[model samples]
Target: MGLRLLIIVALFLVVEIYAYQAVRTLFKPKWLLISYALISLFLLVYIVYSFMQFDRAVGQTQHTMFVMGLMLLVYLPKIVITVILLGEDVFRLGASLVNYLMYNLPKNELMPERRKFVSQLALGLAAVPFLSLLYGIFEGKYNFKVIKQTVFFPDLPDAFDGFKITQISDVHSGSFDNHEKINYAIDLINDQETDMILFTGDIVNTHATEMHPWLNTFNRIKKYKYGKFAVLGNHDYGEYVTWPSQKAKDDNFKGIKNLYGQIGFDLLLNEHRFIEKDGQKLALVGVENWGKNFKQAGDLNKAALGVNQNDFKILMSHDPSHWEYEIKEHPKNFHLTFSGHTHGMQFGIEIPGVFKWSVAEYIYKQWAGLYENKGRYVYVNRGFGYHAYPGRVGIMPEITVIELKKGSNVG
Candidate 1:
């Protein structure tokens, strides 16, 4: 903790210095300087106060929201200024070296002071991201988008051809601040009107009480013909918080599972349920939370107990890493897998076919959208809600509608 604080302070000082240089270079008026100083001092105080109260504020949605806004609006702009200025310094150093080598310039004459235009340019570039983040907080956070995809499978049952499944994941209810916006999101899911609904976990951040407030809103979600099913994510296990006793923790877990029931979802814990249509059965398997570094309570084999080897199977696992590490090459040959833990890091550039990238891609091989290997498939939902970051940027919250088509060459 001490080391982390030192690093944060050091970074803050560097960023502020760069910000000061940029502002001072552009404007020399005493009034302007005084205004800048006061703004900087207030931001610095807020940053320190946020850090000092982090432990107490983290669990409180409103407090954390304020801190996150400060980070995006103030701290992020300073960091961007620092990066732009650092890049400018690198070019300046190269210019100095070139002057010495080519013209045999004296030490005093070799290097010139940073250009005022360079500082102006740095500040200008930094404003782009700062303004974008501000917009993200206000609008992008609630910008729920529906991503439609079609996956073809040779082994898919003809009776279930063109079966539409709506998927949502990572509803960290603890972090939600707006009830009306959440209700709007739920209404959007109902608008899809898919045959089945799959929730790939993280219903709450840590405890069951977080979900109590949203119960009525979620319970109003329109029922699907095939039914709604869900699996636990790492956050659902209450492992991130301290408990007074083991029984208290157990009680919390029970409440979380019961909340799913209240919301009209069948909670699957290493279990399999058959969704039948026209006398043809497609197995839906769901396993508990399992990730490379997170909780690994999920048992795929147990979930597949009654499922046949050739049955058209859909597995609901929280983390995409589970598909990367276990499910993709498993003997069972799950036709389609749904996951939602990535949330695309809630920030990234995703322009369909043109470009798709996120910091989460480095961590989870199958971070978001559809991934195929041989004949198997997995659709990773970006998530239904935001988490620690409070708001999303380029990667908006997602509601995935997958239409499963039978046979090849069917576009």
Candidate 2:
């Protein structure tokens, strides 16, 4: 922590000296000196918090603490914006970055080797913010994806083979301030050649009407022989946002569930339905939002309790962890499970048979994609929406088209 503090201090000193010199070159005001000192103080706190929490584990509760400490600096921006709006809005890191790129960058006095190193780091760091926005564009439309695993049920007849089920998770439609980008996303989903469309969870950021505008696009999406289906996600229930009364919140929740029906989706709540073709059956079971410290994962045990042991089953529960810890170990094994709450966080590496490590792994081993044990398969689709972070990085949104096939009893 001490070493990290030193590094932070050193970086701040370098940037401050450069900034002061640039400001003082023309004329230095006493207020400017005071402002710089305050900014330095804020940096001191931010850097110290970041350093102390730098080594915290991502899976444990400490992980959220780490993120909260870093975001402490982020919240100051809105306060700073309202109180002090002029001369680059120091708290708005984006503004400072633009200024640094456009001006102070050319003024570095370091040696050639040192100069190039700093230049590269500066450019790379600056890229993360813009790259986040680009992530939003691609993620909203479910582009740049990796297929985790394609599961096949041998019990399924040839008639249902190659039946592609498109899965979308975390739409967070209320987050769409950019209509064009959202429309593009809707167009992309509507254009897919999918048989069945399943929305695992999280249809809106809050209000049910938030999804009304997207209906035209969602309507265009080709439904399967079984039709479109959805289960509630943590967000869809409006727990994150506040209402004047519990009744209001419950009303909103029911409204969104009704919206799902209007959009041609059967909102599943701890229920099961069989998809039939050619005298064969594949039971698809869905549960309402539920999990540890998350939504009520609903009851997979009850949802599947009625299914015949011999019939193949597909379970759609939002959080992937449910599959890892609960369903996989259950007595009545599920042939395939589909989940999408992770969104791969809209960032990470999904290279097939390659390395996979991200914060999501800390909480959900089945974070994004397919994991199998025995004959049971869990396919965690990279989601189709963005959330609080507001943009994706390496992980793009996904429109999962899972084509279940028939495999031999032996591997």
Q: Could you say which candidate leads in TM-score?
A: 1
Please list all clashing residue pairs in model 2, or write none if there are none: 152-405, 195-224, 289-296, 290-295, 290-296, 290-297, 291-297, 347-395
Per-candidate TM equals 0.94, 0.69
Model 1: runs farther than 4 Å from truth? 56-60, 94-110
TM match of model 2 to true structure: 0.69
Worst 10 residues of 1 by lDDT: 54-63
Per-prediction RMSD in angstroms? 2.0, 11.3
lDDT of each: 0.88, 0.67
Tens digits of per-residue lDDT, candidate 2, 53-114, equal 54311211233333443443333222222222222334345644665766665434211222
For candidate 1, write residues 353-382 as lDDT tens digits: 689999998898899899998789899999
Superposition TM-score, candidate 1 onto the true structure:
0.94
